[model samples]
Target chain A: MSVSLDPVNIADKLSLIDELWTQRKIAGLNDYEIKLAKLKGEFVWHTHPETDELFVVVSGRLTIRLREGDVVLGPGELYVVPRGVEHCPVAEEETAVMLVEPVGTLNTGDTGGPMTRAAEPL
Target chain B: MSVSLDPVNIADKLSLIDELWTQRKIAGLNDYEIKLAKLKGEFVWHTHPETDELFVVVSGRLTIRLREGDVVLGPGELYVVPRGVEHCPVAEEETAVMLVEPVGTLNTGDTGGPMTRAAEPL
Candidate 1:
């Protein structure tokens, strides 16, 4: 099996990303994948029917809009959107985030639309 | 299923920990767990035969010693120790780190010792 010995610099990899709402794969942990993304504006409401999604804010601010309420996160903060929970992400300003989820999970979840983009290696 | 709506502030959760080399479970992603730990000394060499382990340095420096070479990481840097790889972690100074691995994975891996501690929720 091939193994990566090189360390991944989260900030450095994020610096290479220019598009908002696009995720770049950084590493893999078993059946899951770790990704980095730059996000801004509002994203479509979605839900992963089979897996939970983790969002860790790296810079700026991110607001996860749930039907119940809104969860705001800053740098060094993280929140997990439970499986089958409908939620939309909104960023008033540019935000950098790290995401952890199953390898084949989609960004738009069951509500997939035009915002869906496959995460590629950085 | 209970879903945590509150955002977990990594720095805040880390501030509650006082013991070095002890892991505190911060969150859960599917069957895997997200943990936070503080380190300042050498850890025992061990290997997980069934899973990969991810180490993300939140502050200070971390060195992962492998048979091939040592992978050093600073803040905002991360490294993954592939399955069945013998490795040891060392920190010269106080360092805060985030670890992601399978739920039942132990701190000491296959080589259990006095240094091994069960990760408790924060």
Candidate 2:
């Protein structure tokens, strides 16, 4: 490496996996975290009232659905869901991505449904 | 999309580019932000005194250099550079990544050397 660093390189952490629904915690502050989430197929619909989430698709394709419509995020693209907004995430095929938000975040926002929470902290 | 969404999908935002040195703001709290930074080549040497930055390598390869040694962050790998730590980041080839830090973060931290600040807010 020739360039001098600031103190961290979070992008390096996201390369750990290439599968769907994989959550890898790369870095965080007291209230927020940077995570790598891989996705395939479809996920349950949910929302968060306390904080907004930032999703960046590093590879493959990604889409987010709101109550009214859906937004598609591709490589080098991003979307912000304001707090308390209900939305769903689904990938037609295998997709790799990164997530930044607070810690202890519930997958389904405040409403816990059948597929709301994630079991592991990869 | 089948999974319930919190307020954001940062990975979806990252998919907006594939070039090097492209900085895109995905989301942020009052003081922090989730960014998708496209990087290549070697960056300047610098450090920050008040904040620690997280870099997650989503594609290609990434490496962080400190005065003592260098830590390489491959895809899916993560490293935390404590505040006031001096380091450098370099990629032998083009790499895609996600960065999480504060809103007014300096690329070279407080030291401010050549290549310390970014000109754009992508």
Candidate 3:
């Protein structure tokens, strides 16, 4: 497959996304995928047994709740939820986030449920 | 090694970097690493034969010159340079960027020289 050489404007992509908690793949580096998601309220508590998940808040605030404590993030802040660690992402208002994870990694992770959805290209 | 659950503020880390073109590791996701770099002027033309390199502009603008064409990126923009493609990053003014690539991927890629430096933690 041919890789496009165009730059992806994060804000533009995020504006096109209307669904909350749905990840849209923007780019790929090696086997990992860079995804953008609009998040609100709360996400399911889950763990990825095989890989770490990186969350970068693009707009608004995000609180990553772990068993130990909550890692609150604002715009331009990032947090990594380590492998096998349960994390639930919560946001009071609408938040734009960029996520980096391995290809095929689930959004709901090991605790797949109604919120689980496969990522599609934006 | 224990992973810290603290949120890494991208602007805060960028403020700590003094030298241009130097990369500092901020977080790790599986075998890949997330890095922050301050860049200005031109970088050496290089290619990562083994992996693709991702660049996200946090502040200012960046131009990734590939053999095919130039990809201009402004703040909140990103582009992925495919593996084996020669690329040279240039910024007219000081730019803060976030990079995602495999662990041990060099700043200079296959063309290591005076511009090459090992990434240290931020």
Candidate 4:
């Protein structure tokens, strides 16, 4: 199978679901992976011990709950969750976001319950 | 100097310029930096030898020209330039884009002409 070299349109390629958040890999670099997620409801509080995670809101609003305070992100807005910083992302309505993290990063960092899943490449 | 931990709005934070492409740093992580750029016209041919570069178009269109082919990206679209690959980015009109790369990575890779600039932190 020949791999086609094409630019990934995150909004058009998002794997949207109703109940839980869905993640689809847009591209993989040397050590990093770019993934797009459609999110609703709340995700588990987790922390990446090894690397920082970047969340860029593509559309809609996403609130990242932290111990210190809550960070709300809108479209074109981004926040970096420092390594080992516990964060739970919550969205009142449907939101689309692009995530940048190192390869092999677990979706649910420390807590891997029912929501933990291996990302699927788009 | 107190650094505020707030989300950065790429669309709102973009430092638009009339001439050559303009880039401004949005945030910095452990090993990577997020930058927002407003571009129009052609950029010099360059290559990053050590790390791959990511380009996520926030709005408008951007075309990355390579020796073999060209990749055209639209809003919400992304493309990764592999390490050591020579590429030239050109935008016919004003375009807003977000870039991800390792810290200390030069804007102009192998070739540093007039456009070689040290990124200014936002």
lDDT of 2 by residue, B7-29 (tens): 34444445666655656765655
Candidates 1 and 2 compared by lDDT, better number: 1
Pairs of residues clashing in candidate 1: none
Each model's lDDT? 0.93, 0.68, 0.93, 0.82
* Second chain alone, TM-score for each candidate: 0.96, 0.78, 0.96, 0.90
Off by over 4 Å in 4: A1-5, A15-19, B1-5, B15-19
**Which portions of model 1 show Cα errors greater than 4 Å?**
A1-3, B1-3
Candidate 1: what lDDT?
0.93
Q: Which residue runs of candidate 2 sit more than 4 Å off their true CA positions?
A: A1-30, A38-41, A58-60, B1-30, B36-44, B58-61, B74-78, B91-97
Best by TM-score: 1
Candidate 2 residue A38 Cα shift, in angstroms, is: 4.3
Which pairs clash (backbone N, Cα, C closer than 3 Å) in model 4?
A: none
State TM-scores per candidate: 0.97, 0.68, 0.97, 0.91
Clashes of 1: 0
Lowest summed lDDT over 10 consecutive residues: which window, candidate 3 chain B?
Answer: B1-10
lDDT rank order: 1, 3, 4, 2
As for TM-score, the candidate ahead, 2 or 4, is: 4
First chain of candidate 1, TM-score: 0.96
